[model samples]
Target: TSIRFCLDGDEPGRKAAAELMRKYYELGYEVEDCPPPAGYKDYNEWLVAAKLNLNRMNKRADEPVRA
Candidate 1:
């Protein structure tokens, strides 16, 4: 199984993610990096936005459409 590292887009976060990827690659493990969306600074923010979007979609789906 591959290992995924979800890191923030900040400088420190990017450096840490790079170091981890290098270390794990040297250890012969398949690793993937998942960064947050362009507008988001981190995963948590993106996650919240995604959840909110989902909730809005569900709410709209439950509403009756006008003729």
Candidate 2:
């Protein structure tokens, strides 16, 4: 089984997710950090954006993003 870390896509949220992933990894568990896609913040934001069929950028939209 794999562990997934679903968290907010913000600075603090990312850090928290990383910490959780690390903790779980250290415990010998496979972990995945699954945050919402680049622009969205959380699951709610992702859902809202998906429903509206629009790109929703969070507050940190200016920050660098993953490819």
Candidate 3:
């Protein structure tokens, strides 16, 4: 099973994530870091952008491609 990480842009958040990453690394678990989108303030903004991206991808996948 894979774990999803939502990272924040703040200093404290970054530090926390870094420490967690180290621990995960030591445990040999596959971890992915989701960085905040450009122009975003925090995780909430990044989440919104990520959701939008996922929605767009789903819509595109459902559409028929033209030859």
Q: Which structure among the candidates has the greatest lDDT?
A: 1
* Per-residue lDDT over 4-63 for candidate 1, one digit per residue giving the tens place of the 0 to 100 score: 889999989989999999999889999999888898989899889999999999999999
lDDT (10s digit) by residue, model 3, range 1-67: 4545667767777787788877887788877766676678686887788999999999999999999
Measured against the true structure, the TM-scores of the candidates, in listed sequence, are: 0.77, 0.72, 0.56
**Residue 28 lDDT (model 2):** 93
Winner on lDDT between 2 and 3 is: 2
Q: Write candidate 2's Cα lDDT for 1-67 as tens digits.
A: 6899889999999999999999999999999989989888898988986766534444357668889
Model 3: CA > 4 A from native: 46-67
The candidate scoring highest on TM-score is 1
Shift of residue 34 alpha carbon in model 2, Å:
1.0
Give lDDT: candidate 2, residue 49: 69
Q: List the residue pairs that clash in candidate 3.
A: none
As for model 3, its CA RMSD to the true structure in angstroms is 6.3
Between candidates 1 and 2, which one is better according to TM-score? 1
